[model samples]
Target chain A: MTERQDCASLLVQHLGWIERVAASLSRRNGLSGDEAEDFASWAKAKLVEDDYAVLRKFRGESALTTYLTVVLTMLYRDYRVAQWGRWRPSAAAKRRGPAAVRLETLVYRDGYRWRQAADLMHSRGETDLSEDELGKLLADLPAGSRGRPRQVGEAAMAAITDGADAEAGVHAAEAEQERQALGTALARAMQGLNDEDRAILRMRFWQGYSVADVARAMRLDQKPLYRRIDRLLSRLRTELEKAGISRERVRVLTDEDAA
Target chain B: MKGRIDDAERLAALLEGRVTDGERAALLAELARSDDGLEILGDAAAVTRELEEEDRAAGVLPIRAPRPGARPRLSARTGALLAAGIAGLLLAPLAWRAGRIPQGSYAMNLSRRVAVAGKGLPPGVGSAPRTSVRGADDGLSPGARAVRLGARQVDLHLARIAGDAAAAGAASRDAARLLHAVAGAGTAAAVYERAAAPAGEAVADRDLEAADANAERLAGTAAVRLGAWCEAARFAATRRDAAFFRDTRREVAELAATRGLPSGAGPALGDLRTVLDGGGPVDWAGLRTRLDVLLGAAGG
Candidate 1:
């Protein structure tokens, strides 16, 4: 066979690893294979362009496979950041096509559950997962939290069987949350806490802790406890900057409210 | 800045259970500082609050371990009391074990398993734990300290054939150990728990009721199955294992039986049988190819 065939064969042989890397990036960062393929092709192009000089030296440092894995990973990260910067607004853009568009719509606008499931499956390709396992994971999703709310089990089975284009659906859904992005306000609101305060805040607003229980547990007398709560609110207000959420949104609820 | 107050001392006194009314007032005033300092103090208080909330929510919280600086300051008498408390908590597993039945087939010989499983214990242990070396019974690998805890063909093969009791029982203890090894190799616990259902049945209540008998039964059964597989793998490797499996020897072994056949076929075949039998190298690609061929053949 020709050199091209040899290279192609080698590429085909390691296709699983290459795909695994792609799937992992998709899962972790919600990148599609088009995005994944772009990163990989760029890495390979760079590695091969310079007369195989860097690639040869890389061969000596680690096994060719290991070196390729590292280089591909680094290149993907750098290329992704660069690509991301180049098309900032289009970061949430989904390509045309029923499958891809649907995936993007589901992830971005429909429900966090399908996006999360797809993200997990994408992130963990052939990762000790069986169809049954994925099915079970879908079934176990918070009892009543299906995106379809209309479908369960077999209907949900479409997610996997139709998955050839289902991933396009993931890409589509990813574009949905573009409207309400994680921004500076949320980031700042999260600041100024030692790990403990952060944990408490998480337990409180996010986790929905009640004031009375929190006060009692912290061993604070009510007056002093009220003061601390005030300080937390003030800090949160300063941090939110204008995340559209207000002090009223910062809830400390009883178990009844939590339920 | 305002005059520095030794609130640390006041808090230390409070922590020491000697909080005077005067000291309590002073500590509260200092804790109410604003901006960054207040934030830091608030964070500390909040962390303490979180710890408490975690206690209430979780129903139990890990004890506050004293930092190194505070260690020597602990009164020896208090230290002794603390040590006793530590001992009681540390031995909670022993207390827990005393009351409960061993849950699964792959019972970690507590002492032996602990010696190897350094750090990141299942739930409760006092001492530092580490991943221990695979024992002789755990099976050895070809190279120097090649104690690889990779996926067992048996487990994968059994999991694929769910509801098959014969395969499940013969492979239960081995499958569980394979999972133990896989979990050691960083497989998620959910996978094992799912596998454990079938594995539980494999080594039934009656089997485990007699510990020595159970161990002997598993050891002997695994030895036979593994011996057959291992021997088959070795011979196929040397172009002999396949020979035996086919109920024929090298005298009539096919040309394909020769090692290093084209497309790495013969060697790959060796890999397939090796993995299928007792413990062997993880030739993932070879196994996949074998499956593909078998799948194709069956389809045809």
Candidate 2:
């Protein structure tokens, strides 16, 4: 048989398998019945596109069914992304790697709480970060208007930002300036450390991974990692002191309720 | 370009649970080298699982039937005797559980004889379905029996290597039950060891073909068992069940390096041994793929 004939024959033989796989994909992505049928049709067309380019990619190393499943899955993901526009991670999250980006997407875009996002990530073996760690990682992230929207009325907003009284507004301005100064000092101190030390700090404190997890991921002994983190913290404290940021001031700035 | 194609093939094999230990390790290493690779692995797995669920719901078999022809011939009397013997073996466990047959009694002796007799049967007879009724399988041709057994083995091995403790444990029990049915209370390991031993001389082409097919089947079964144990170890490691992980790892290493296995199985086994001994994180997915490939190659 000619190549086209061969492809057509193969497609006819595996049509049931293809539709089953497509339906499964649609169900997983929460497609309606009509949408699922549409997806199946789209998948069939895509398979025959470019003269069965996707189907022809099979190399016979694995079972024909398995190869087709992987191909169809990739196609399904593409279809979902095109239709739903999956949440894009910010450049900052991207820099932290895929795990961080996924966590951010789950929380900021998908409306999951920090703990829920961390739990999801852990279940998928994507990240081992605790909820607190996930919170810390995104603490400095530029807030997006996706999940947690502030819907204060004009009066409430004015009372809070402008303040009900002038004295209250002045006190708030002073506190904000002090908080920014402390944040700048903390960043400067972090920059003084080596890359590995910085990463260790980030994993331990910023990302909220437990000591054991960080040690395991980095292939370090637990006891040594614990000591190393302490030493790094001391170094950061010394740097902050040099920058005129006192330990007391740092504590107040970092205090959640105080802020 | 070739590398990408090879990786895709490797990924497909991994997804289908058909890779050897070595290929699994290589693919995992490749995936671990980049975030994109990990993302792809996760995505592929997620999709494949959904399809598998659908397959299960539709009552589809995990594996296709054997190719047509190549049936090993057996006399009618022999088929009947084998079927009756296998049926007795299947019920031996229940008899033991019911306290009707004591350990190492008449039932045990009878099972040992049946096991020995079973060795002389066709290559795929070792994997005969546990659900077969007495005299029911006797009516089918040897090729049909082989197909039925092959499908059953695939399903069993897939369950064992499913990466869930409950499922793997249940599969182990089923496998044990099958072995117990055959050996009349013999340990599963003993049967596996006997099966893994070198085959005797075959005088005729037909005998040689049967021996070769049997050897391949045994090897494939061993590879699947190894994969299952490795998967168990991986699950245990995730749960920090050190004892279970250690025990399963040791078992896998021993099985992989068993004597008289095909030379084709050496590289994968060797790689598995190295990984088990490395004292580092085991790439269970990679090891699973490698074993899958070995099983597939063995015609399982």
Candidate 3:
């Protein structure tokens, strides 16, 4: 074969690798099947457009496959940032707070179950996620709590059918208000803590660091560290209670960090 | 500006596990002081996660292994029949050479039966079946084709073993075995070219399977031949039996040359020279283990 023909054959072989990289990028960016195919085709066209200049310039510093992977990854990341640039999360998701996009990506795109995704997120330093908190983020409310309204409706039909609609609306409204108030109180109390204290809280709760790790990192004796942690929780409880958060709500919030 | 760029590079290095202890301490100190430090760490972490995610998505997955108890796609009964057929073909040459079977009857009956059965035709007179017979003068009977292919397989196995032995400096026994197998292969190749020369239709599965068995037997035969040659070479070298070495070398070289073998007298000649000059290191146990592995893979 002539040099051109040999180069063409080499390019043909790399087409499969390029397509695979493009497909991965598409999947990462949550593109549909057709979009993924289009992305792959585009990547192939770009590689070959100027007489395979990109391939010709390959210096053999790394394996051709590895070089292509890094190139494709950078291209894909650039494309995604140019297109989306943190515009993915809606106001509601933003209100749901930090790592919401990551949570969704893990649960939906990566196909991780909620708890596993939550653990991964925490490990990656999004440390505020308690297991129950993560579950709530995924709308995996406690079975009885989420299902209680339906049970109440069934009982209302058996006894107070006429007043059922009004009673149910009032109860749901009250519950929503309480939930919102609890979220606000927690957020405010968390923000009120100094940066060092917040970091300690994260290390202790979010990251699931052992008490020993926390003490070592904080340069405190284990006994003093434990006492300091206890005092911090007590202060949070008082602050939340002042803002009308019930003791039960505070207990629920603190329960996740008991480990 | 330089300090921020340094910090960014340090953070990237930290994520990639290239950060030094002092840099790690500095990065940790920065992280503890402010939210901006935390944001830098989070972004670095996110980039690391993305790279990992891409790798998982794009990495070549391992080929699923063949399950245990996986036999050839051909049934066990079919394999057994093939083995039997190959055994008959292979034995014909040896038996005839030994004067155990009448050559005339063996050739006429076995050839006619193999041809007819192989073509899936009745033994009735038909000119059309004659056209299906590939090599009239030197063409292989169906049985001969099986034997020939099996012999070729044996030759290949011997070559591989010989190569391995040479590599491991166990060249003496392996070289002799290889020379024997090469000669055998030349004969087998000639038999196959004359007897089996690509008849228009695909060779039947039974014939192919029989050939596989024949190849294994041929390899075994080659191994036996190697042992005999090793003994002969050792005797010739140790006793200064120049006449024996001269004769054996000529025979091996002549057969190899006729077969268009690249290493005409190379290995056998080299092994003889080694033994005669001053014996070289021969890892006999290692060579045996290697042969066992090869034979085991070949279903010997």
Candidate 1: tens digits of C-alpha lDDT, residues B1-300: 132222222232333223444553454444333222222232233334443353446433222222212324466699789989998999877886743554422222111111111111111111111123343355432221111111122222222223344333333333344333331322322233344465444433323323322332333322222322322232122211121233322212332243322232244444445555644333323433453342222111
DockQ of each: 0.02, 0.10, 0.03
Measured by DockQ, the strongest candidate is 2
Q: Indicate the worst ten consecutive residues by lDDT in candidate 2 chain B.
A: B113-122
Candidate 2: regions farther than 4 A off: A30-35, A81-259, B1-7, B20-22, B57-59, B64-300
lDDT of 3 by residue, B1-300 (tens): 124223333443333333344554555555544433343343333333344354446531111211212324456699789989999998876874644322322112212211211111111111111112222244433223222222223232222222222211221122222223332444433323322332401333233223333333453433333322332232222212233343355443443334222222235434434443453433323332332232222211
Worst 10 residues of 1 chain B by lDDT: B121-130
Task: Report iRMS values in order.
Answer: 21.5, 15.9, 21.6
The C-alpha stretches of model 3 lying farther than 4 A from their native spots are A1-7, A87-259, B1-181, B184-300
Per residue, candidate 1 scores C-alpha lDDT tens digits across A1-259 of 3334334444544444444444443433345556656666666566556554433332121122333443444444456446543211111121111233223333433444554645654564523445464445444222321222333476567566635487787877765553244344555665665533554444344423345434432233445555665676677665553666444443421221233
Best prediction by lDDT: 2
Residue B262, model 2: Cα distance from true site in angstroms? 29
Instruction: State which candidate, 1 or 2, has the greater lDDT.
Output: 2
Per-residue CA lDDT of model 3 for A16-88, tens digit only, reads 5566657655644445456567667666776676776665554332234434554554455445445444323
Which candidate comes out best when scored by TM-score?
Answer: 2
- Reference-based TM-score, model 2: 0.33
Return the TM-score for each candidate structure: 0.27, 0.33, 0.27
Error of 2 at A223 (Å): 27
